[model samples]
Target: MSSTPESKPSALNPDNKKAPVTNSMPEHISLDKWADTGYEWAGEVEPSSFQRLATVLSTDHEQTKTQLDANLYRRNNVLHLAFTLTGNVWLTCQRCLQPVAIDLSDDYDIALLENESQVRLVNEEQDYLLLDEIITEQSPERLLPFKKLVEDEILLKTPMAPKHDDCEMTVEQFGEIPEEEESENPFAALASLKGKL
Candidate 1:
């Protein structure tokens, strides 16, 4: 979606000058000012760049990357974050226990809430993004780490039990099933003993 750029003054500067924002994604960002100014950030990041995400991946294969775009704006005095993430990740297949390539692409729009009390104010009409104290007040300048948000979205999109459409491996691959040999039933022996008695 495209909108005509509004001529609002930069929140960082009171002189109505454009804020000098970098093209490269920042590790942390201020949501309040960013949303008020209608700022947008886009970049591509490797899965291995995120420590939490890296641990879940089957392998750190090269050439796999996630393209992300985030747009911040205010709606009805509420901060909103719109995100788009697209990439391919290698995950362990639950069925075969081998690496399975999974394509991830999703778009999400969520309102940023200041506290749990604010969550109750948000109607069921929209989704809300609640910030923990650690990410909000505790962070320097009340900025949140962008990597953590990106990693969270990727994790949410990942399947709980990943499996290929057509698995090459079968149950036999796990282990061999022993042949069943016929044996006399215990009930038959009891019957024989009863007859002798």
Candidate 2:
């Protein structure tokens, strides 16, 4: 494929690891173009920038940022992506209902395919993603929402039920389990009236 004028030397060079991250990195891009051109991008986005994540956050993160690095290239005519997401976030502790700080770090090397028919392109060492599942909002098989993709990775890393290893709150403090008290049954009065009748 012929290179576009906007494609820079660093973007053209798939092995250029030292290339600096730029503000020109787009939140979304054409998956076809990125793989065809061997595009690479790196950036840090605030955790608060994530719409779904922001609502679940329990701590004040005015300064925290999630680091994201993505590299897309074609090998043997199959597109591959090397992606990383690392950052710290705070979630509500299920035990005490307080903020519990968590550190997230993950790395993924995945094969991108348009459908299940292309699954043979991937080997055992790599994971794979079907465009049919992820590219719903955009074009059928072209556009990729990179920002949401990274956010999804972070969400996967988050604990399902987050709680501190050592909770400071006592049993009474956490939430008191109501004690069952012995009481008269609701049907007792009816039973007595029925006997009298």
Candidate 3:
């Protein structure tokens, strides 16, 4: 969650950036109902639950286990979320062009707005998210699915260009070398010839 820093009394949960994200609360619910009691839930969702996540990952291999925790609460009628996602992942290092093991760990705080008009109420608060839903007479329902919410949030966190601290070009990617591979590199002879010249 990216938001402007503020110390106002009505500041949407200061922990939005530190918050964990969720699933299984329900397809949709009356925002007013949950806000009254300050509903909270935390749990892990399976890797397969992130259908969009797979397409962005670089590996043909399946994603390793991932764990996530999330809490939803509100301040002054403004919905806020704190989410944490952690686990192991294989991402291709943009520089090395090889799989790099990344220990996935990230936290997000998001303030969800019911309508753009409400932005003024909490515009100064950090990480505010307002979705513009197209409502028509045939499809007037404006509720977004719980699963979609989680997926959208997580997907936004994916790195555009994942990389390792050091690119290991000196080493061969395939560890096991065949017996014949013991031969010196063909470039070695070229270098030796250059020395003689």
Candidate 4:
């Protein structure tokens, strides 16, 4: 029995069309092509899926969730990505050292650049995604990973130091503080010695 090469999928074939991308799908896609077609994906994703984000979260990874609404389109010879992320995450409170539920909801508009050199040409008013030349030089994969993109957005929104607006617990409550005792001023002693001299 002989097997035909046409039966197998090949990345080299330019004519072969890929399946439509969805929020749940973990795949890399060509940003340029996706923008030309005006592709859109909307769905919910578990917070646990974001490995990097889970490291900083105060609560269990499975307890949180996020909703993603994204659209890719080309306008004015520039590829644009419009996305909205909404979710609730448990972050460690800086003051109380307890879990603080933070509501996360934000919309972003980003311009995708084919090369790092094009980043300088992008409008200062808009956000831009600069493709890494080093990575592309090593691999033929021009498509960007959808899951990694989502993870990046979440990481960007993560607070450096999250804290509650009004913490019921105070520093004094956490530990005991010794009362400070007053001592003679060094300047007064120096002045007395100078006077004697």
Tell me how many clashing residue pairs each candidate has: 0, 0, 8, 0
Candidate 1 per-residue C-alpha lDDT over 1-197 given as tens digits, one digit per residue, 9 for 90 to 100: 22222224555446653434564456666654554676666767677777777877886345477787777666666766677888789988888888888887888777777777776656787777766643745644667666577677778878888888898765555578798999988798788799687
Q: Score candidate 2 by lDDT.
A: 0.70
- What ranges in model 2 sit over 4 Å off? 1-25, 60-63, 138-141, 173-197
Cα lDDT tens digits for candidate 4, 1-197 = 11111111333335544445443644455654553555566677777667887788886323556777766666666766677888788888888888877776899887877777676667788888765631253345456666677677777777888888888666456567788999888898788899787
* Candidate 4 residue spans exceeding 4 A from truth: 1-27, 60-62, 116-121, 133-141, 168-197
Give the winner by TM-score: 1 or 2. Answer: 1
lDDT of every model, 2 decimals = 0.69, 0.70, 0.57, 0.66
- How would you encode candidate 2's per-residue C-alpha lDDT over 1-197 as one tens digit per residue? 11121322444655543333456446676765555666677766677788888877886434377676777767767777677777788888888887888887778777878678777777877778887787777455577776677677778878888889998764556677799999999998898899787
Candidate 4 or 2, higher lDDT: 2
lDDT of 1 at 109: 78
Number of the top TM-score candidate: 1
Pairs that collide, model 1: none
- Tens digits of per-residue lDDT for model 3, 1-197: 22221122324344323212334334343343343334344454555556776666666546776665555666767776666778766666778777766665787677777787777767575777764451112334444344566667666655678778876655456676657547668898898899787
- Candidate that beats the other on lDDT, 1 or 4, i.e. the better one: 1
Better of 1 and 3 by lDDT: 1
> In terms of lDDT, which candidate is stronger, 1 or 2?
2
User: How do the candidates rank by TM-score, highest first?
Assistant: 1, 2, 4, 3
TM-score of 4: 0.67
Clashing pairs in 3: 3-127, 16-109, 19-82, 19-83, 20-82, 20-83, 20-84, 21-83
